[model samples]
Structures are given as C-alpha cells and as structure tokens.
Target: MPSLTLEQANQIIAGALARSKASGFKPMGVAVLDDAGHLKAFAREDGASMFRFEVAQGKAWGAVGMGASSRALMQRAKDNPNFFVSLAATSGGRFLPQTGAVLIKDAAGQVLGAVGASGGTGDEDEAICIAGVESAGLSAG
Candidate 1:
C-alpha cells in the first residue's frame, strides 16, 4: 500500500523536465497523481502552452482511474470509441485516453501513482514519463 510522496512527485517532475531538455523536446508540462487519482504535483516549463498542465493532468488522472497506462487506454479507445466517449463524459472531461502517461509502481508491483507529460509528440511524451518514473526509482507501467 505504498503511496506517492510529495518529494517523489517533485522528483518525477524534475526528471521529466530534464529528460525533455536533454532530448531537445519542446517545453513540457508534467503532472503526478496518487493512486486515488488526486493531483500530487505539476509543472509547466517556460514557453510551454497554458493548456499543457490540464492536458498532462487529464492523461495521468485517467491512468490512475483506469489502473492502466494512458497508451493502453488509447488502444482500447480505438476499439470502442463510443465507450471511451462515455467514459470521458462520466469523468467530467477529465479522462483522456492518450499516450502520454504511465502508472507508477513499486518493486512489489503495487501501483503508487502515475506521471504524465504534454507538449511533445505522443511517443515523446510517453518516453519522458517513463524516464521520470525510473529516475524516481520506481517502475513504469
């Protein structure tokens, strides 16, 4: 029953931003959410769009809610667009089935939270999330 700490959340964001910068990706926004789908931390780099945090949070929120990676949800949504649309409505527009977020898991495979990013391509965004999770000494799902 491990939970994400504020320090870990901040580390995740810092790692994500660092990765984005090292890769020469555009300015990025990152969000972290605990297992209960509550926002734990967030960051938007200078020059990033105002909407980045919302997009990143939406992606992570959906991951924490569904207990899966945003990439996985994106694939599922492709098979059932109607169902996903309904899900979005039920989440009050917070659920976003996109490829920019991943579940954060402990060594025992317990879900601790999720990390998500915006301002890059889907692959780029997902990569940064993974990097952040690993940097925090957690696994990414």
Candidate 2:
C-alpha cells in the first residue's frame, strides 16, 4: 500500500494554515492520519485552543477508520445517532463523525489517508483540509 510521507504531511499543514490565514478564519489545527488510522502528523496554530488537536485528530481518525470522509459520516450519524455515539465510545474518543475531515486519495483513486481540521466552522475547516490535500498534490474525497 502506498504510504503518506512526512514531507507530504508537512506540506498539508502549511497549506491548511495558509488557507486559514488567507480566508481570515480562526487559528486552525490540522491533523493527518495514515491509512491505518495512525496519526502521521498534526499542527495546532499558536492561537488555537488546546482542544483543537484532539478534535482534528478525531475527525481524521474516524475517516480513516470508517473508509469514508467525515462529512459522510456526519450525515450517517444524523440517520443513526446511536451507532455513531457508540462508535465514539468504541474508538476511545479518537473518532469524530464530523464535517471537518476528508479522505485523501492518490491520483489513481487509492485511499492514501485523511486530513482534518478544527478551530473554525465545519465548512471552513473542511475547506482548508481540501486545500491542504490539493496543495500536497493529492485529491480529497
């Protein structure tokens, strides 16, 4: 399986933060999780809240674990709230079915990992994640 390189992870973060800044969003936190749901890289902007890392990582972890974007998971959660709650408990709080994460895919459409962000509205967060993935020359799902 193809792996997410650290350099790519760094580029994602840089791009995410740049997008956030350019868009006048709040200080953001970004997280990248490998295909196995392992945290590959993370960053919390200086003014971001302390909870940013866990929230950002949780969203990314959920995307990698469920093989879907966090936005999709959020929609599913709305249809079956109980199951998603159980998933959070089962994940030991590492999973968050929210709208702030996107699955990362290679040019061939292979899932590479996921990118998530926090410290803004869900849409704003999701936008930066997509930007970061694109900036890294990857696609966002």
lDDT of 2 by residue, 1-141 (tens): 788899998999899999999999999999998898888899999889889999999999999889999999999999999999999998788889989999999899999899999999999999999999999999999
In candidate 1, what are the lDDT values of residues 58-86, reduced to their tens digit? 99999999999999999999999999999
Show model 1 residue runs off by greater than 4 Å.
none
Q: Alpha carbon lDDT of residue 8, candidate 1?
A: 92
Question: In candidate 1, which residue pairs get closer than 3 Å at backbone N, Cα or C atoms, i.e. clash?
Answer: none
Clash totals in order: 0, 0
Worst 10 residues of 2 by lDDT: 90-99
lDDT of each: 0.95, 0.93
